[model samples]
Target chain A: MTALAEPIGRGGAERASLARRASGWLVLALVLVSLASLFVGATGLSPFAFLKAMLAGDAVDLRTKVVILDIRLPRLALGLLVGASLAVSGVVMQGLFRNPLADPGLVGVSAGAGLGAIVAIVLGGLLPPALAAAMGYALVPIAAFAGSWLSVIVLYALATRGGQTSVATMLLAGIALAALVGAVSGTLIYMADDAQLRTLTFWSMGSLGGATWGKVAAAAPLMLAGLIAAPFLARGLNALALGEPAARHMGVDVQVLKRVAVVTVAAAVGSAVAVSGGIGFLGIVVPHLLRLSIGPDHRYLLINSALLGAIILTLADMVARVVVAPAELPIGIVMAVIGGPFFLWILMRRRGLMMGL
Target chain B: MLTAETLTVRLGAHEILQAVDFTAHAGEVTAIVGPNGSGKTTLLRALTGDVAFTGAARIGALDVARAKPWELASRRGVLAQFTGVAFPFTVAEIVRLGQASGTAGAATDLTEQALARVGLAGFAPRRYHDLSGGEQQRVQLARVLAQVWEPLDESGPRWLVLDEPVASLDIAHQIEVMELARAFARAGGGVVAVMHDLNLTAMFADAVALMARGRVVTQGPVTAVFRDSTLSDAYGCKLRVNVAPPSSTFILPHAALT
Candidate 1:
């Protein structure tokens, strides 16, 4: 048995444990990146000074306190949650579709959420004032979450029949859905007043620029639900890598797995998009990079994706803040600028592997 | 034992499998052989509960349709005709998926042993997609083998339901795979394989179920079902079955002895 086992060649247990170890390093990177994010803003806030102020409790000035607590702290928290959400959603979507290229943004989930947000911004005044006040700041995120949830359910229905999902159909339908969403959003944009138009513009082009503790509190529950569901889904998703039937044969409930995966992706991506607009490529780019490194076993892939995604997106948000100084480029633009090339690099390097795609 | 009674499978407007009755006893290799559209694979699918069908299909006491997936999985492992991995997974990783249930007996780590059984020793770390068609098929076989490693346990005998288990392999590997199936059956497990090659089926299958257009033409032992006229009519072509010489180099009458 030992002789036979010797040639087994890196059993999954070892690789999974290796990924577990790798995640510790990723957590460390996330912490370092988060620290860098806190201090790498346009303002002259030094970490040493912040540490000193922390130790000497009453010495920090009001402006400095506001800069760290109200401004940077909320932004960092939102970035971490949103980044983790996007990356984890990407992992789930790709695993659900069994394709590395599948992303929430590509599948119209983000567009649907955008449509819901646009609807809220343009026609919010028409709502009964009391009800609108009741929903409070949560109205947009709720609407966005609903839109994304509906989008996934619709896409799933369109593509699945007899308990089987056709990846090709889901993707083509996603394109059509995105086009339809763009049309609807266009009409709403036309209806927007000047201030509403300004808000719409900022919302459509993604940003953490307006991050508040309230927004973080609103988004965290949905995103956290998705993140929590990911670990449970990891083994099933790994089984699903061998096609739906094979996974079922291996005792995975294929239909339940698909439903849970769809909901997880929708909730996470919807809430993130609701808070931060359309942060493209983070989903696709993060999971793909992690798979290339960690070998696509979702057990560790999902966790490492969360950690690495938080790190990368935090780093990108920091760059977005610092690149244009006090005037900020939307985090979406920064993501596209970096992620677009990285995605192409992946394509160029793995062109042979893309033959199936 | 595995049995399907009045099994019918419909796709869109057509009934792919029409009230097909079949049975395979424990500790025997039962082969399903037929023409291209004769529903051989569909029958296997129905038995495995991959497709919805009306009628009763049961492995042991568990109803295939009503039983939970894990319950069925613990009793049998299925080898699909074509299994594609969506992402890059090592051969070892693919085989380890079979161990996910942890029901294959006291020894949970059958990855290496399973690989060696399928002639895939030392091929574990190789990427599944990087392998040739035949190699991938064997890797999948290894995975299935790991899934139901022991032939019998406290519950009852396990089963291996395979669809076209060796459609792509060269003749040498084909023999290896068929022997693996035979050995599995000989170990008190049951194996129901959909076979394209009649000679291999004759050599390994303890019983044969012949079908024509979703209906069973005849089903019995190899000698009874592999008759010339029966096979010719079922396949819609002339097929002559000749008993090879006892000392023949390639074809042996080993199944006849069984």
Candidate 2:
């Protein structure tokens, strides 16, 4: 037994170090990407000059201050929050369902939030004038958050019975829900005039262009709350990878884990969608890439997903800002373009595993 | 001792398990043997509190159904027949999940020892998905072992509730696992295994419970329960029990005449 144990001790140590190294590198990458994002926008304001001016307490130009502080700073912060929320939510959903393909967008949570935002946009005029005026710009996000919670509640009700949740049922129900919500959103779009149609188009296509201090302030608390709650779920999610029965046997309250995970995903994604629109693929792609590089230990995976998700989204937002120069491209288009092919590659590589689906 | 009395399970309109009484003593291996659909797995589930059942089940002094999951987890470990993991997890990571029951101190050392005991030394870094079916089963067994690494705690004895643990292993590995069970029992732990291979069962199990159609046909010490008529009637076939030297027995099923 001693002879057999010798090699394992070395291997276990090596794997532990490897995970540590991977996490270290991901953190470094996130910091570098964030710094680069501050300088890579269309306004041509050098981050170095801005930093130097601010540090020296010298007179700074108004355009540079507005570009850096007003626009880019809030945008960067929103990108980080939204990205981290979506990615963490994706990790939770995948672990909860015991399937790699589970994502907030694919599972209809994002669609539900999008519908909520659209309803607020299209129907806000119907509210009594005083009430609509009082809600101000906060109405869309509030409505979107409410919509997200409602849809998740409905989805949970449909997918779970007798303390067991069926992943297949959840996925199918998500697809159906997406279609139903899309139809309603389309009807709203048809009723809208040209200006409302423009707002709807930009919102649906997904962009960080509209990021503002108010939006960031509104969404950050919910996203932060969800992100903080995620690490506590690491152990339960890890046990769940072995399947529900084995997870329960490991002393994890599987039912409670499911409830917490669903609520977390909904709150995070709902707040994100309310602010950033339906940013596709970051949730799915970030966690998938991290799992490929590092093993599926949710303890490390959740943190790394948050870091990498933030990095990737910030970089993508930079691309969306610069690729079209004076005219910005939607961040959703950028993510979908990169993520769609990567998703296909993962599917092809894991074709045998997908057969079980 | 782990005890279950008047356990009955109903799913929809069908009864999966009828009223059944089971008792597995500490420091012994109890094997439940039966044909397919004999409710062997369901019985294990009920005992582990994985499924709702109308019965009284207790491990030591705590009622299984009412005990807190984490509290129960510290005392009992379970191995399911089929375990499907979605992401790529290393064997070590999978084994370490057993520490979720709050066995944080010494968990790493115990995980390594557990893997070594299952003949999977140096497999800590190996991906669980890349392993063969038998290897994965052993990995799961290693996880179970890590969960109950110490056979006895402040509590009297721990329990290992397994569902068809060796159904996927090769012949040699089957004996290896059975030997682990025997060793565990020797160390003063309770092991209740749902088994299909009667030869292995006869060799390793101190007590045998034979079941047919959701009911225990007969249960007792190995020698008394391995009688020819009881097994033959329960299995719906002709079986002859051959007693071998060193107090072992083997059951052979006779072929039907054309």
- The number of the candidate with the highest DockQ is 1
Prediction 2: B-chain TM-score: 0.95
True contacts kept of each: 0.68, 0.63
What is residue B166's positional error in candidate 1, in angstroms? 1.5
Cα lDDT tens digits for candidate 1, B107-187:
557878999998989888777877899999999999888889898888989999999999999999999999999899888
RMSD to native, candidate 1? 4.7
Q: Local distance difference test, per candidate? A: 0.85, 0.83
Residue range B87-175, candidate 2, lDDT tens digits: 77778888878754635345346777888899898788776777899999999999888888878767688888888888999888998
Candidate 2 per-residue C-alpha lDDT over A248-346 given as tens digits, one digit per residue, 9 for 90 to 100? 888898888988888888888999988888787887777876665555678888998898888888988998999889999999999988778867886
TM-score for all models, in order of appearance: 0.92, 0.92
Per-residue alpha-carbon lDDT of model 1 for A72-133, expressed as tens digits? 89999999988999999999889988888788775668878988898888888889999999
Cα deviation of B244, candidate 2, in Å: 2.9
B117 Cα displacement, candidate 2 (Å): 1.5
DockQ of each: 0.56, 0.51
